[model samples]
Target: MLKKGQFKNAVKMNNIEKYFGHTAALKGVNFGVGANEVVGLVGDNGAGKSTLIKIITGVFPPTNGEIYIRDKKVSLRNYNVKQAYKLGIEAVYQDKSLGEKQDLWRNFFIGRQITDRLGFIKVREEKEIARKIMFDMIGFRGVGISAESKANKLSGGERQGIAIGRAMYFDADLIILDEPTSALSLKEVQKVLNFVRKIKESGKACIYISHILSDVYEISDKLIILDRGKVVATIKKSEVTLKKLSEFMLKYAHAK
Candidate 1:
């Protein structure tokens, strides 16, 4: 149960810390994404961005911290990626996570397939669902692409759409996108941004991590700046312009 005046957050990490032998990857960081909020997590390399995300996604347990999902605390002692998924937290990486050699339908259900009691894969049902996800849920309109098409035939942005669509189909409450728009054409970047908008429209929370200040500013409701394993600032989009945000980040990039 939530406290009297506490706002409901999709995910919250309190005093989170992680260490690698003598090195501290994160230090007493308080991070969160509100229900249906899009949070831009911006930081330079080695700023503990990936480390923080890995902990949230249960790649590894934080050395110290508390994780709460919708006011309920999670036990970190046995937390894993599968457990994180069960908690409705999913991470979409820069890789887009598609099988190059597999068809779209196959890629969508790679590890979690639809099966009958006899253990037979429901091939046709999976294909139909994939079709709905492509054309309906995600508005994926890749030319010459269909459920039968190999994933390698899609462009970078199309791949991201597929990954995001899969996350939505699986009912993720909080989707953490790690450098989602890296190394893409201008048009392709726009494609990924549109998909993110879809996530917002569906009323799901998102933590969008990116180095592209303009794109991050465009989609995020609020921005969290992390420096040296601690949060330096949390700026609302209404409070800062893209140019100003870039300058602010540049100052941190050069800080000794």
Candidate 2:
């Protein structure tokens, strides 16, 4: 149960720290994602962005600090891969996480297959759900994709769209996207950005981890800049422009 009168942040980490032997990956990182905000996590390689996200996804627990989902504190000892899903935290990593040869429906329902009393997979219902999600939730109005559409046929951005759409359909409250727009054409990048907007529209929060500053600027309400495993800047979009953000990143990085 939530504590009385507490604010319900979508995801909150307080005094988070992670260390690998003597190497410190994160140092007392404090962050939060609001219930309907898009916060971009940006930094150069080895800036601890990935480490922070890994902790968020329950891939690893932080060595110290607290994690709260919607104002309720959760113990790291009981947080696992299954618990991550149960708590409505989902991650769409850079890999796009789809089987190349599998059709869209199969990819959507790969592991958590809906089974009947006879222990058989429900084929038609899954297909219909996948189709609705692609067209409605994902806004896939371009080249027609049916249940039989193979994953190999979609573009990088489209693959991301489907993966994100699947997350939304599962009613995930917080979705973490890792470099989702990497290596895509300008048009495709826009489509993926639109999908991120869709996520926000559905009253969900996101941690967008990316190297593309322009897309990050375009989509995120706030930017959290990290340098040397510490947060250097957390500025709203209204407070900083793309050029200024780029300059800030470089300036703080050089200070390290």
Candidate 3:
């Protein structure tokens, strides 16, 4: 649970707009995510969900809008991928980018690592961190495979675990998961959803993007529905029904 003041407003966008050669992708979309909250971003295909994610993650600049982190309005002009990481905002795309040929520890520390005084990669320290993240933080109790098992040898759930473990290892404030369980089995999906819940318990906000309304309802605390580049409604999970949410999406599409 997020203690009072544990997580500030991780990200906020006001009157955000985006255009692709005259095609309006996002029109004044306004939303925000707080620390340790799981907010679902749901919409049909071409509903501007991807565009909004891109802008929020600094993949692209909003043509017109203001973004704030921890209540400070800041320009995102040169804040690229590196800057996003520095802000503790990490994104895990649908593909679960892991090297199938590499072992678990190697994949976990693919980009970030600690160096020894001699300027050499500290293998022992890296493995120790990976072990702690996988077993302690993530609760993965699988067969004690030598942090040397190839990613392909693991199940889909395990690969998903690796991706999530990496994000949490970096202590990301807001984690964005794009269709995380799209290709997993029912049981695997359940495992991943449990992990998402654990993420919230660890006091990190997650933006779960998916078309599966049922999954979103099960895992998210709030729902933000986007249609044709506009926010139709943002509602608390307790105050919404599947039928009502479906209706909102349909109505928004028609209005567009």
Candidate 4:
């Protein structure tokens, strides 16, 4: 059972709108993501998914309407990437936001870290944390690369593991993943899907934005279809058939 203020849904957008100069990107968009639930956001190339994510992450404020976290209405003004972290809202974009030359531990605690008494950086502590996070939080049990393996040296699947592990280590209540498995092989895609499922089992909400309907059906607990800056439907995973979801995505693509 979820408490009223606890926000089973970590994010709620009511009539969200975004305008760049004079062009409108989103118009009266509304959506919600529940706790421990994997909600799939499916649409064509320019269905306002990125805009919506930017709004939720405080990259930009909505031109109109309300945005809430844990049911508390909040202003997005002055809220930057760091603020988003404090709010327990983390976004893992398709571009893999890890430092290529930096090791896994360095990338994991790049922006945030624990320091020693004299304000010296604590490398050992960070590595320990990273190791624990990779194994416990993300269920990654692959090659025993020292925490010092460069991120670029990691394979596609391994890099993804590092990214997801970082997000989980931050104790993020809501994670927004944008095309996480877009560049991976079939086997690697399955590995990423397994990590997503683990995220839900750990009782955190995840918004998976993907163009792949099959992936969505395989891993999502709910589906939210967005078309031309508006939400077309929000359906339960059990209630939606793969054929129905594919049809919805196709219709949305054609409508755009």
Candidate 5:
């Protein structure tokens, strides 16, 4: 639960529009993620989900619209990954951003490394913290993995867990996940999904984007359906059955 004065919405995008030359990717997309809410973005391929996420993360600026972080309007003139990270917005994609050759601790702090006053890396501290984050925050129950284990050596689900844990460790207010369970075995998918529950339990919000409607139905508190670059409907999970949500998506799906 949020203490007395915390902002209600972690992020709010008003009339977000994205264009690729003559093509319109997102048309006036208005969305918000409240604290501790897990919102699922479900749509067929090419329904503008990626475009909207790109705009949110500063990979591409919206052609027109306003974005607010913690209820304060932010100008997009200098929007970039650095600014996004500074604002506590983190993303975990299916590609698993860890360096294959690097160990777990190194991958955990790949871009943002802890350093001493003289610029020497605090390797020991980083390893301990990484171990705790993976074992505790991500619920890695097996306990065989070590901080020295290479990223490539872990299973796909375990790597995804590490990435999510890194986001939590950094105190991200809203974590965007782009198909984090793609192409994984059933067991691996379950493991990755469990970590998302961990995120919700931590009182942080998440924007989960995926084509897997079943996984979305199992986890999301609310569901947003997009068709042809526009939001078709926003339904609370409690308000409808999974079969109904699937029907809605199917009914609105169209070829671009």
Candidate 6:
């Protein structure tokens, strides 16, 4: 439990709700993620997963809710994508975050470049920094991969690695990953899971969204199960096995 006047979660939402026209997307949902924790968000399609994430990332304001980032309440009216970045929240959506044609170095600093006093991009500095991020930060030692490598030339897993490393390099407090392991091969899935472990090792929090329960079982400290716009279950990794969790979801789906 969180105490009064004490910071606990990296991000928290209280009674979150979202409405579209007369229909409700989210219904009084409560959620949170703590530092050094990996949370798996698992749910069926149209379960309001995307809607909830959008609200948290400041893509849109909630119809009714309070959001606290690092224990500080956010001003909904002023919260935007730029504000979310400023507050140390970043999202990495599968296949949508990177520029396929851009070099690795360029992708790393695409929107937020390192510039001199006169607003000139420091190309050499950016390349060196990108190298550290790729090689040291995310441990991307894949053969034939370098700072100058174009994103489109890399595999899906490699592209995800670069995106994740870039988020970490920027010092984001809470990183949200949407469908990170979708359509990945077994080896590539393992690679992505390893990258997620890096986030936990660095004492940063991650909200991992994926349909693969096995992958979630392997890395997540907690599992949040959502259904029809509500958080129905929050299971700790210790309390259940992969098989039991799967069975529970199947049963829950049928019951609903």
lDDT of 4 by residue, 73-117 (tens): 776676666777788999887545889999889999987878988
* Clashing residue pairs in candidate 3 (N, C-alpha, C atoms within 3 angstroms): none
Which residue runs does candidate 1 get wrong by more than 4 Å? 1-7
Per-candidate TM equals 0.94, 0.93, 0.92, 0.93, 0.96, 0.94
Clashes of each: 0, 0, 0, 1, 0, 0
Winning candidate number (TM-score): 5
Better TM-score candidate (2, 6): 6
Off by over 4 Å in 4: 1-5
lDDT per residue (tens digit) for residues 35-131 in model 1: 8899999988889999998998989999998998876899888788988998888898766478899998999888889999999999999999999
Write out the backbone clash pairs for model 1. Answer: none
The total of clashing pairs for model 1 equals: 0
State each model's CA lDDT, in order. 0.88, 0.86, 0.84, 0.83, 0.88, 0.88
- Worst lDDT 10-window in candidate 1: 1-10
RMSD of 1: 2.7
Model 5, span 9-128: residue lDDT tens = 988999988889989989988888888899999888888998888888888799999999877898899988889889989999865598998898999998889999999999999999
The predictions' CA RMSDs to the true structure, in order, are: 2.7, 2.6, 2.6, 2.0, 1.6, 2.6
lDDT by residue for model 3 (1-256), tens: 6566454788889999999989999998999998768999998788898888888788888889998865567677876767777778888865558987998999999977688889789999999999888878887766856577788887787788888999898888888888888888998888789889989998889999987888898899999999889898899999988888877767655533
